[model samples]
Target: MSNSANHIISVSDLKKIYIRGSEHIHAVDGITLDVNQGDYTAFVGPSGSGKTTLLHLLGCLDNPSAGVLTVEGKAVYDKGKFMNERELTKLRRDLFGYVFQKFYLIPTLTVKENILLPFAFYRKAEADKTADRLADLLGLSHRLSHLPKELSGGEMQRVAIARALINKPRILLADEPTGNLDSKRSEEISDIFCKLNREEGLTIILVTHNHALAESAGKMVELKDGKLI
Candidate 1:
């Protein structure tokens, strides 16, 4: 368990190395960090600097090669030991929400259906109320019935954001969320993130190459060559 009662994520000397033939790739080199509850932290670095890798490890989407990673007081990874797929799945579904660079919305599904897809996976009752609230928050309420193909880039991103929030996750892990958006849309998305962090006290860890976008977070951690700077 993390010593700090309010720490939602605690990482100590964490690493993720990949074996590419005879070569070793350190995607996430030794890193020690803490993210408190309701924190809005951003990881900024160039491509291949391990920003996304660190986010994946923290979100329980990937296991660490070494060291300890605890979330909400539970050790998700320690040394070579890691939470099994089943455990990780539960953690992701129950405590974490993810948004990727690409919107990843289902082309055939309506905005509402896409947002409610997680409920189907968990076999839980559909959270229509939560979905509606999030849709309104993200300005997607008017496009609930539209398909992904019918919406604009900003609208699609809004739908993605709403979908991620439908589960009411404790932590939101976003990887270059505004990467595909125009400057105006990116600013809108940034504002939405700040609003969520401020109003709902959502814990957010964002990975971005854009320093301006990253500056919106409460704390910024820069990485270079897979090591924090």
Candidate 2:
């Protein structure tokens, strides 16, 4: 583990491979990149280009089959070893907030409940206060008590965004955040991401096929056939 002054994440020769009975699929093949503090990076590529796979590796949601990955300058994966699950959980809990395309909120949980769900895994004394603030920020204050089924698709995605922010993570990892929304809703979500990166100074890394959203990023990385293009 090394200390990085500005580089929040550094990857070297990263690769993720899946093996079938007789085939080896190289989902992410030998890609190296760096994400600095306050960087809004979008991984954009066509389907099966390994954009999502690379994002997963960066977020520690999935482990790399081979390569080096350092977060905040400390090696998470190096020399054929990766951090244990507990350490990885701590790393994720402390540093990353993830928003997915599906808006994975529990149907039974209200907006507020869904937002504060992270507290169940990691205790935070200001959980309620944070949730309220995020709700207001995302314009979901009025829907805090509503169930997921009662909200529109955009509203549900906002709830998911609020839930991700409730942990006060330094890095926001989003995968196809606007994939389920219409154009208008997609633009709204895009604006929200821009605000989060510009105003909040959050380091954002997102995987998207939406070129417009990808264009809003400070850095755009295109992938093809599992490698940087």
Candidate 3:
């Protein structure tokens, strides 16, 4: 439990249950954690341990079956109820940026186009300037005009990172960000994450099996059977 004023995210007894016919699967069960502003936290566990599910809940990508989730001192979910979808969507768009294991980039869209896709939902002042700065920060400035198919695995992931940052989200949620990369490429991504947290002051929460990537974070949270261990 964290009581600091800077705690950006807080979860208490969070649980996610899925029903498959008569069987109930507890993907995330009774987990509690706190994430401070600009904190780099890694969630590590086995394949069925609910790491990704937890991340989804935190990012507002999924709803929890039970729990209290507080973001930035506001209650998003409490006592079996959640914030309305409109507000949740705003939180997802303005407060959290997400990156997944798969690049999820459109093959036909150039890197710049892919990075700018989020702008279709909400307008940003000087969107191009913001994208350009993110591209430079993520080392994607030179490859912005190339298609996803033309880039290496590392470059593609960098573009994804830039896209996630274009909204200037306060938190970055990544699930198995380096799962598809070679060791060298994975190392590069790890370094970029470090720079994002340390230099750019982005709060990063990631779920990963990669030991080196996990070690780079300031905090390590281990999960097992959907519970913190």
Candidate 4:
């Protein structure tokens, strides 16, 4: 702990490999990383080098094959057993916010509805006034009523960011968040992450191929050949 009592996430000797046809292919080899609270960090590497695999492990979308992962200081994998599926789901809902390369908003739902989706499932009444604020902050106030199809790519991604924020997660795990966008658009998303890191103190773990994005972050880590090389 770096003098801040709140390290949003931590990984210890993490490993994830695939066993197929009696062969082992390491997607993520032994690696350890720590993301302190309020960090704006970037992970850069080639595909299959374990950037996305590590992000998935951090997001709790997938568990590591062998290692310890502690998010908000709670063990993600322990005693040879990962969190139960039910526990993982609840943990993801309560502590983690995810922004994927492809915006995963519900097409039929309005932007506002999409932002408040998780609240409907887990919490009774919506508390996404923060989502609206985020929309406005991300310059999407005008697109709230529009369905996803009516919005531009950047607009849809901004909505996805807002949806991720609705849960008020301590950690935001963004995987190639700007992967599908042009250079200028990608910077806009990076700017948002920087702003959140500065103003709201949200910890961000972003995986990207863009050097400019990496430059903007406070810390940068690179992975190669399934290891932090």
Candidate 5:
């Protein structure tokens, strides 16, 4: 990875509480963590153990009820002149790239257009070159004309990965990225992630329930009751 060992995401005494009627549910309780730059880490937990909730907070999709989160050395929402909507949107657009279980490509668009879609909102002169390079590396040079509906599941997910990397994000956040694929496809995707981590210095955070699958990660963090175990 980057190998700088500098912290990219730091969470301090983070807590998330949900109010249901009169009862308070503590989804995350005083969880503090640091994710180094270019880390390839996996988060594992049982259902309702707050793995997803914690990921949302770390990814800046949600605000924590208490404690502090600093992303890229800036204080998170509303703390010390914290990020406004414009800044948050910019951060999301410029810093984090997301991959989910579903390959959410537009059904009507061909693979090339789908990969080039995000650049339409924010263009860089090098965008096309980057897309072309990733396409070659991902073995999708031949599928450029295929539509999302016309591709197989693994093919679709590979397109999704290419789309996510188009911006060359600071962190790649994946929530069970291989959840929709078969075992062979899962292994293939895992190898791609490992390649990203090693070759491109991508910081990847994955949340998965499969222990056998999670071991592929360099560092594995287990969550129990929303706290690291």
Candidate 6:
């Protein structure tokens, strides 16, 4: 299959199965999807509907048991052509940013430190200017020196967002990013995603159960029982 620059991710007949004793649970079955560059797509599903599993697979956090999965026109997982752990790590670090329901920031680190953690991991020089710019955009410039404990829930989530973007990833995968926030904070987070998508042309794939939040995206896909409906 040919890969297009506009298609950041493409998958066909993707399947992820887990065997528990004699039971075979198909977390994701026969999912064919394409995520275009700069596209904001949301996946909605009930609990146990394989939304998270699908996200994980797309993010290269997990391997599929069967199917073709490609990122940036390169096949990352296809039968015997799976990427190794180190390559997967590099792919995730350089190409993808992740945000989750919990703002997984280090409690002891200041906002600036937390945001720069990815640089430290990659042993790359700190991009203070970029960090500051992202902080300003996320409304966290004033909170740079503050620790996670001192920030409000919304502020913490913003910090998480900044940290995720520190690597300047092409794709941002958010799984229930607004799940822990109040309605107002949730809206704020949703607005941030939209703003980033519009201003920076960031490709975003969000998995959310909230109809309002899902509708904010340019595309909405529903998954039920490991299949798109």
The candidate that wins on lDDT is 3
lDDT of 6: 0.91
If scored against the real structure, what TM-score would every candidate get? 0.94, 0.95, 0.96, 0.92, 0.91, 0.94
Model 4 weakest 10-residue run by lDDT: 119-128
**Candidate models: Cα lDDT each:** 0.89, 0.90, 0.92, 0.84, 0.85, 0.91
Query: lDDT per residue, candidate 5, 170-214, as tens digits?
Result: 899888888898888888788888889999899999998766568
RMSD of 5: 2.6
Clashes (N, CA, C under 3 Å) per candidate: 0, 0, 0, 0, 0, 0
lDDT of 6 by residue, 1-229 (tens): 5346679999999999989999999999999999999999999989999999999999999889999999998899997579777888789989999999999999999999998877644335447877899999999999999999999999999999998998889999999998989889988899999999999999999999777799999999899999999
Give residue 221's error in model 2 in angstroms. 0.5
Candidate with better lDDT, 1 vs 3: 3
Model 4 clashing residue pairs (backbone): none
> In angstroms, how far off is 170's CA in candidate 4?
1.1
lDDT (10s digit) by residue, model 1, range 28-146? 99999999998999999888999988999999888789999998888899888877778777888899889999999999999999998776343344588778888899988888998
- Full candidate order by lDDT, most accurate first: 3, 6, 2, 1, 5, 4
Model 3 TM-score relative to the real fold: 0.96
Give candidate 1 misplaced runs (Cα > 4 Å). 1-3, 120-126
lDDT winner, 2 or 3: 3
Clashes of 4: 0
lDDT of 3: 0.92
Per-residue lDDT value at 216 in model 6: 98
Lowest-scoring 10 consecutive residues by lDDT in candidate 1? 117-126
